[model samples]
Target: MKRLLIACETIRNEVELALKNRAVEIETIWMANTLHDSPDRLRDALQAEINKSEAAYDEILFAYGNCGNGLLGLKSEKAILVIPKYGDCIEILLSETDNLERIRTTTYFLTQGWLNGEKTLDIEYEYNLKKYGERRAKMIMNIMFKHYKNLMLIDTGAFNVEAALPRVKDIGELIGLDVVISQGSISPLEKLVSGQWDEKFCVIPPGHPTDYDDFLGISLSKP
Candidate 1:
């Protein structure tokens, strides 16, 4: 059966890395990375994509998380919708199940997709500099990032990790946050694309509308 993978640009690198060297037939459609900044925009954009590709594939897989209640009202009548139930792309980047609980409290996660996405930590800082003077930008970001003390980068094995260090170091120094690097896996995205719809996934059938409950529940079983 043919399947379409509708993914957030924020985790595009991980999804691409997951399909590497594997005989997977699913086609990918990368949604704009900036959509996550506004969930309503993300929902409108996703529904539009679903409408555009519904006839071409048997199923559509969404490689996204709850994303700040963005996926709450999205639904499709043309094809079955498959998506992960995590909170956001951060959870998808930090895809290791065991490591999530351990690191959730202390760190903010980043990935190649995130590094390149809109409103990325460094990009926001730069935007602040461009809009406001250097002194004002630093002060603005200091208040914006006051809660976190750690910047954790999850290496999903797709891009050059070392090449990203200078940017990471800059963020750490700017926010007084310690930089930590960790290993990541493609298993989550791989499974979602491969039809291995385990507990982590929500399989919504055609003609049914998805609401906030889909992402909030413990188990989103197929009917």
Candidate 2:
């Protein structure tokens, strides 16, 4: 079946890595990372892409998670919509692990894709520093990241983790948080692109809007 993968640019490296050696040939469309800042806008952008591409492909795969309910209302009029059953890319990267909930509460996840994004934590820090100077910038950053105790970098094996360490360290220090490195697996994305849509995926038939219950299997209030 012809398939098109629409994904967040923040996870481009992982998605590309997953595509390697796959038997399936799925076309890709990378969405802007900045849209992640607003779920409503993200939803609109993804729906627009789906509307434009649904007729050309038999299946449309979303390499994204619920992402603050960004995928809540997405639907395809022609192609089936497939999405990973995840809350965010961080969960997808660490899908093999058991302590995801604990990690989510105290850790700020990082990856090469996130670091390379247009509006990364470091980029935000620099912008603040330029506008408010060092002292105030540090204060602002501290307040923003007060809930996070560690900056956990996922080594997805798709990029050179060692090459990203210095920047991760700098960001950790800037935020007064410890730096941590964790192994990550691309198997979930691999399964996604290879059409292994098992229990780990939310497969929405054509004409069905993606529901919040599809991801969690529990009815939660829509955002």
Candidate 3:
């Protein structure tokens, strides 16, 4: 089957492993540059690649669970596949077992702490990010990992990296269900501007969890 691998962060290793295991033929590799707003541009570029591919693949899959990057605009005549983001997949895997309430509680607590501004690494210039700043970012990640570890226990009955990789590995497995894949990529700012990806792809980046995003203070206006 004809395949496309859209490279994105977090899932690079997983994608390679899946391709190796499934023996899927990768017809083209589209790498989007997400340096600045490049993630947004990358989504557009991927869409353009899809149109240009001339329907060569019977199906397409988004390799990363983080397909929220501006992809809602893409409507394919062929089968389109998506792997839910890490958070969603974790929620799903947790659902398969018991303790849904506990998991929700843990996620809630961690997310809440993040919104309140917890910091692990005391980096300077953290306030420049326009979001919760670096302090809050690390806090959110730590909280996520804490809850993520607990969630993994539902699968492995313990908390460890072994549990975590499997969670990511499962995402790759989901992508394998389809023939074509859409994923995210990293790029230098220069490559992003020259590539013109936004003409086609759309980036649908998810917001910080409702309770965790301090940046919710930013004013949003409908154009």
**What lDDT score goes with residue 190 in model 1?**
80
Measured by lDDT, the strongest candidate is: 2
TM-scores, one per candidate? 0.89, 0.95, 0.38
Give per-residue CA lDDT, model 1, range 1-223, as digits (tens).
Answer: 6788888777777777677636676778888887877877988999889888888877898888877777766777778888887777667766665757556676777777777866877778888899998999999988877877789888878888999988988888987789999887777788886678888887888888776566765323322
Candidate number of the best TM-score: 2
- Per-candidate clashes come to 0, 0, 21
Q: Alpha carbon lDDT of residue 152, candidate 2?
A: 92
The sequence of per-residue lDDT tens digits that candidate 3 reaches over residues 80-112 is 433233332233223244555564543322111
Order of candidates by TM-score, top first? 2, 1, 3
Candidates 1 and 2 compared by lDDT, better number: 2
Q: lDDT values of the candidates?
A: 0.78, 0.89, 0.35
TM-score of 2: 0.95
Candidate 2 residue lDDT tens string, 1-223: 8889998999988888889847656778999999999999999999999999999999999999788888898999899999988888888899888878877789998999999988888899999999999999999998999999999999999899999999999999989999999999988899999988899899999999987678875224564
